[model samples]
Target chain A: MSIKKVLTGNHAVSYGAMASRVQVISAYPITPQTQVVELLSELVADGKLDAIFVNVESEHSAMSACISASAAGARAFTATSAQGLALMHEMLHWAAGARLPIVLADINRAMAPPWTIWTDQNDSLSQRDTGWMQIYVESNQEAFDSIILAYKVAEQVFLPCMVVLDAFVLSHTSEPIEIHDQEKIDEYLPPYRPMVTIEPGKPIGYGALAAPDTYMEFRYKMQRAMENAVEIFEKEGKLFGDMFGHSYDLVEPYMMDDAEYVIITVGAVTSTARVAIQELRKKGEKAGLLKFRVLRPFPFEKLRELLSGRKKVAVIDRNISFGHHGIFYQEVKSALYPLSNRPPVFGYIAGLGGRDITVSDVVDIYEDMKKRETLEEIIWKGVKL
Target chain B: MVEIRTHGRGGQGAVVASKILADAAFRVGKYAQSFPQFGVERRGAPVVAFTRIAESEEELPVRSNIYEPDHIVVLDPTLLSIPDTFAGLKEGGWVIVNTPELPENLDIPAKFRVATVDASEIAVKYGLGSKAQPIVNTAILGAFSRVLENVIPLSAILNSIPEEVPVKPDANQKACEEAYNMTRIRK
Candidate 1:
C-alpha cells in the first residue's frame, strides 16, 4: 500500500533517497537544497535509514566522497544547488568518466553574481556536457519517484544521473504525494551490484592511465552505455508505472495528438504551460504541450516523431545561452532541423532568476508564435526592459 | 480551488501556518500545496506565504506564486499598510487579520469581508511565544477556519496543530480555539 503525505520537494527527495536505501550520502548544505540532506542526516542518526551520512567540506568534496563511496560498491547519493553544483563541475566529469553510478538531486538555482537564491534552469543546464543523465521534473511527486528510477537506470548504464527540480517552486513548495511502500520499492529496485569494486587486498588499479591507444575506447563505451540508457529508461519507466501506477517517459506530450500549435517546456514551467494549454483548448485553440523529462540522451527521434507536422513550435526556456538562443530552444530546433517539412521552432527565454511565468504569459507566447512568420534570435518574455 | 496568501514578519510562523493550512486541507482529503516567498532570513523582515486547496491534484496545476487570492490572512496587522498585502484580492474575499480592533475599525475596502481577532493577545495568553512577538499564526489560522468555515473546518485545524507545531502544541491549539471564538466579522 502507498502512503500519502504533504511533503516539500526537498523532503520528498530525502524520503525517496531513504526509500531507495541509499547506502552512502555525502553532501554539503546549500540553499534550497539543504533540507534534502538535513532530513537524510536525521534519518541516518535515528536509525530509520541505515546509511553513512558523510560530512563534506564543500560541494567538490561532496561529489568526491560520493565517487569514493560508489567506488567502494555503495549506493551513493548527494544534493546541491547552483553555485554548489557549479563547484562540482570537475568532479561531475570525474564521477561520469570513472563510470560510477551516483545519483544527485540538483535543486535548480540561478547562478549568482547578483547573488540571488531563486529557481532557474541555467544551473543544471550548464552541466549538459558533463556526461550526467539529467531529468528535469515538473512536480514534487516526480522528484521523489525519479530518485529510485534514476538509480535503477544509472546503475545499469554506469553513468551518473542528475534529478533536477526548480528551487523554491518545487524545492520549498509542499504538495501531497503518494509515498510508495519500502518493500514495493525494494522489489522494483534491487541492490546496486557493480561489476567492479575496490576491495581490500584485491589490489586492482582504477583510473590509472588510459593511453591514446585506449583513451578513445573508454569514450566509445561510455557513449554506447548512454545509447543503451535510452532503452533502459523506457523499460524501467514502464515497469515503474506498472508497479506504482505513475508512468514517466523521456518526453510527456499533452493534448498534442491534434494540436496545431505546440509549446515545449521543462521543469516546473510545464505545469503552468499545461494550464495554459487547457485554457487555450477551451477557447477552440488547438494548443499542446510537450514536457521534456529527460534532458540527456536528447530523445531527438521522439521530438521528430511528435513535432514533425505541427504548424508552429514554441520552446520556453528558463535558461538562456548568452549571445545565442535558449538552451532547449537550440536543442529543439536542432532536433527538427533534419525533417524536410518541420514547422518553424520559435525560441523564448523567460522566468530566469526566479520570475514567475503565469498561464497568461504562456498564452501570449502561443499567440506570439502564431503571428511570427520567421524565427527571431530570442523572444524575451516577462523582461522589465 | 481556494487560494490564500499569508502576510507576516520573519520568525512569526507564517510559513508554518501555510503548511499547517495545507496539512489540514490534506487531512480532509483535499489536494493542497503551500510555499513561501522569503526576501531575506532575518527577523522583523516582511514574509509572505501561500496555501492552495483544490478538489483534486489536477485543479492545482499552475506551479507559480498566487497572484490573485480568494482570501488573505494578515498575521501582522502592520503588513496592511503595504499595498502588496491586499493586491489582486478578489471581490467578496475574506480579509482575516490579527488585530484587537473589530472589523469595522480596520481600514480595508468594504467590498471584501473582514474578520478581526486579537490573535497576538490570545497567543500571549497561552504563552505561545514571547510577549513582544507572540506567534499569532495558529490563532490567525483558527480565525481563518471560523470565518472561512466553508473552506476548512475548525476540527481539521485543531487536529493538525499538534502535527505541525511540535513545541507547545497545546498552547497553540488553545490560542487557535480562543481566536476562533473571539473573531468578529463584518460581512
Candidate 2:
C-alpha cells in the first residue's frame, strides 16, 4: 500500500533506499546530495531500518566503500553531485569495470569554477561513457521510484546505476509522493544475492590489472551488459507499472500523439515543457513534449522511433559540451542522424547554473523552432545575445 | 489552481507550513504540490516555499515555479522588509502574516487582501518550542485556512498538521485551531 507524504527529492531518495532495505550506505556529504544520506542516517539511528551508515571522508572513499560493500554481498547505496561526482571519477570507472551493482543518486548540480551550486546535466552527461546506467526523473515521486528501479536494473545488468535529478530544482522541491510499504518494496526488489561474493575460504583476485590481451574483452562485456539493460529496463518498468500503477517509459512522450512539432527535454525542465506544450495546443499548435526518463542505455532507438515522423524538434539541454553544443542536443542529433527522413533537430542550451526554465521560455523555444531554418542550430535560449 | 508562496527565516516552519497546506488540501479532495525555493541552506537565512492547489489531478503546474502567487504567507513578519518576500505577487493576492501585533508600514499592494494573526504568541502559549523560537508554522497554517476562501477545511488542516509537524502534534493542532479563530482579515 502507498501512503502519501510530501517530500523533497532528497528525502524521497532516502525513503527509496530504506524501502529496498539497503544493507549498507556509504556516502560523503555534498550540497543537495547531503540530505539523501542525512535522512538515511536518521532512519538507521531511529531503528526503523537496520543498515550500516559509513560516513566516508571523500566521494572517492564513498564510492570505494560502496564498491567493496557490494562485492562483500551487501546491497550498497551512495549519492553525489557536481564536484563531488567529479572527485569520484576514478572509483566510478572501477565500480563499473569490476561490475558491482552499486546504486548512486547524482543530484545534477552544475560544476564549479565560478563557484555555482545550481542544477545542470553537465556532470552526469560527462560520465556517459562510463558503464553506469543513468535514469533521469521528473518528480519527487519518480526520484523515489527510480532508486528502487535502479537497484533492480543495475543488479540485473551487473552494472551500476545513477538516478539523476536536477539539483535544487527537484532535489529541494517538495511534492506529494506515495511512500510504498516495506513488504511491497521487498517484493519489488528482493535482497541482493551477489553473483560472486568474497568469503573466508575462497581466495579470489578482484579488479586486478587485466593484461592487454584480456582488457578489450572485459570492455566488450560491459558494452554487452549495457545493451542488455536497455530491454531489461523497459521490461522492469512495465512490471513496476503493473505493480505500483505508475507507468514508466524510457522516452515519456507527453501530448505527442498529434504533434508535428515537439520539444525534447529531460528531468524537471520537462515539467515546464509539458505545460508550455499544452498552452500551445490551446492555440491550435501541434506542439508536444518528449522527455527522456532513462538517459543511459541512451534510448536512442526510442528517440529515433518517436521523432522520425515529426516535422521539427527542439532539443533543450541544461548542460553544454563546451566546444561542440548542448550535450543532449548532440545526443538527440546523433540518434536521428541515421534516419533518412528525420526532422530538423534544433539544439538549445537553457537553465544552466540553476536559472529558471519558465513556461514562457518553452513557448519562446517553440516559437524559435518554428522560425528556424535547418542552418539555425544551437539556439542557446535565455543567454543574453 | 491556487498558487501560494510562503516566506520565513531559517528554523521557522514556512516550508513545512506550505507542505502541510498542500497535503491538507489534497486530503480534502484536491490535487496539491508544495516545494521550497532552493538557495543557501543556512538556518536564520531567508527562505521561501511554494504550494499549488489544483481542482484537477492533471492540471498541476509542476514545472513552472510560482511566479504570480494568488496568496502569500509570511511566517515571520520580519521578512516583510525584504522586497523578495512580496516579489511576483499580483495586485489582488491574499496575504496571511504572523505577528504578535499587526504593524503598519507593510509595503504590500493596496488591492491585496491582508490577514494577520499572533501565531508566534500562539506557538509560545502552546509551548511549541523554546520561548525565543516558537514553531509557529502550524499556527499560521490555521490563519491560511481562514484567510483563503475556505477551499481548505480547518478539520482537514487539523488532521494534516500532526502528520507534518511530528514533534508536537497536539500543540500544533491546538495552535492551528486558536489561530484559525483569531485571524483578523482585511479585504
Candidate 3:
C-alpha cells in the first residue's frame, strides 16, 4: 500500500535508509546533503527509525564512522556532496578496498573552481578510480530504489556502493517515489550477515599494511570483486523487478532499437533528451536516447551493440574529463574503438556547474548529429563558439 | 505524482521539514522523497529543497526547479520577493508560507490556495530561539498539516520529531501544535 505525499530527493534517501532498516548512519552537514542527515537524526530520535545516528564533525569523519560501523557487522549509511565528498576521497578507496558493504548517497555537487556549489557530476565521477560501485539516479524514486538496491548489491559483491543523485536538480526536486514495505524489504534483504566480521572474540585486523609481494593480490581481488558486481547488479535488478514489477537495466534504451542516430547521456539530462527525441521523431528524425544508469561498469559491450549501425552517435556529458572530453563519452568512444561497424562518436559537454540543461540542448545535440558529414573526436555544447 | 518545493535559507532547517514530511508520509504507508537544492550560499543564502509523494510509480527524468507544484512550503517569506519563486506554481495549488501577514503589496496569483503564519514569532514565543532557524520547518509543517488534506497528521509529525533535540521535542513541537491550531487558510 503506497501512500500519496510530496517529498524531495533528500527525504527519499532517508526513507530508503529507514526502509532498508539501516543499522548505522552518520553524515556531516553539507549544503545539499545536510537535509539527509538532519532528517535521519530526527527519525532516530523519534523512534520512527531504529538506528544509531552518529554525529560526525565532517564528511570525512562521517564516512569513517560508517566504515567502522559496517566493519563491525552493521548496515551503515552516510551522505555528502562536493568538497565534502572530495574530503572523503582517500577513505572512499579505503572503504572499498576493505570490502565494507557500505552504501552512501552522494548529492552530486560541483567542485569549486569558481566557488560554486551547484549540481554537477564531477565530484562523484572523478572518483571512478575508487573501487566502488556507482549508480547515478535520474529521479527521486530511483534515488530511493538505488540506495536500497545498493546495500543489497554491495553486500552481495562485498564492495562499497555510492548512489549519486545530481545535487539540486534531482536532490532538491520533489517527485513521487514508491516506498517499499518493511516486511517486503526484510524478505528481500535478510539481516546483515557480513561475510567478514570483526568482533572482540574473533579479533580480525582490518586495514593492516600488507607486504609488497601480497599487495598486488589484494588489489587484484578488489578488481575481481568489481567485475563480480556487474553480475550481482543484474541479479539484484532481476530480484527487484520480481518484487516491485519494474525493471532497471545497466542501460535503458528509449526508442533506440531502430534509431539511426542515438544521443547518449546520463542523469536527469536523459529525461529531457527523451522529450527532445519525441519531438524530433514527430519531425521525422531518427533520434533516440540511451540512458546510462550504471556508470562505474562502463557498459562497453552494450554500447558496441547499440552503436554498430548508427550513422552518427553523440554523447552528452555533464562532467568533463579535462583535456579529452566528457568522461562517459570518452569511455563510450573507447568501447566502440574496436568495433568494425563503429559509428562516428561525438562528445558534447553541457550542464556543468549546475547550469540547467534544457530540452533545447538535447535538440542541439541531435541536430548536430544529423548535420555532421564527418565526425570530430569531440564537440562541446553549451560552450561559447 | 505531486511535486513540492520548499524555500528557505541554509540554516533554516528547510531540508529537515521536507524529510519530516516524508517520514510522516512513509509512516502512513506512502512513497516519498526529499532533497535540497543549494549553491555556494552559506547560512544566509537562499536554499530550496523539494518533496514528491505519490501513490504510483514516480516518473523518471525530473527537473531542478519545481514546475506545476501541488504544494510550495516557504520557510522564509523574504525569499518570496527575491526571485520569481512562484513563476510556475500550479493554479489552485497550496502555498504555505511563514509570514506574519499575507503580503498585500506583492502580486499573488489569484487561483492559488494561501496560508500564512508568523512562524518566527511563534518560534520565539515558544523559546525556539531569537534567530528561530530550526523551529520554522516544524511550525510550517504543522500549519501545512491543518491546511493540506492528507499532508500528515499532527500526531504523526509530532511523533516524528526527535525527543533528543530540546528545540525539536519541546519548543519546536509546541510551535507546530500552536501553528496547527492557529493558522488561517485562504483559498
The top-ranked prediction according to lDDT is 1
Q: Candidate 1, which segments miss by more than 4 Å at Cα?
A: none
lDDT of 1 by residue, A265-312 (tens): 999989999999999999999999999899897788888999999999
Per-residue lDDT of candidate 2, residues A1-385 (tens digit) = 6798767789999999988889999999989898899999999999988999998889999999998899998999999999999989999999999999999999999998888888998899888888888999998899999999999999998999999999977887767789977777889898887889977799888998899999999999999999989999999899999888886878999888889999988999888888898899999999989987887888878888899989899989889988899888888888889999999988888999988899999999999898876655677788877
lDDT (CA) per prediction:
0.93, 0.87, 0.80
| DockQ of each candidate relative to the true complex | 0.88, 0.60, 0.28
lDDT of 2 by residue, B6-114 (tens): 9988888788888788878888888888888867767788988888889976888566578889889998888888888888888888888898665344566788878
Scoring only the A-chain of each prediction against the true A-chain gives TM-scores of 0.99, 0.98, 0.97
User: Residue A259, candidate 2: how far off, in angstroms?
Assistant: 1.7
Q: Candidate 3 chain B, which ten residues in sequence have the lowest lDDT sum?
A: B56-65
Full candidate order by DockQ, most accurate first: 1, 2, 3
Q: By summed lDDT, which 10 consecutive residues of candidate 1 chain A come out lowest?
A: A295-304
**Backbone clash total, candidate 2:** 0
TM-score, one value per model: 0.99, 0.95, 0.76
DockQ of candidate model 1: 0.88
Which candidate achieves the best DockQ against the true structure? 1
Of the two candidates 1 and 3, the one with more favorable lDDT, higher being better, is 1
Candidate 3, residues B1-187, lDDT tens digits: the string is 6778888888777877877776676666666656665555588678777776666333434454455678888888888786557867888888888888854533566788788888888877876745646457888888888877576788878876662134547778888899898787764
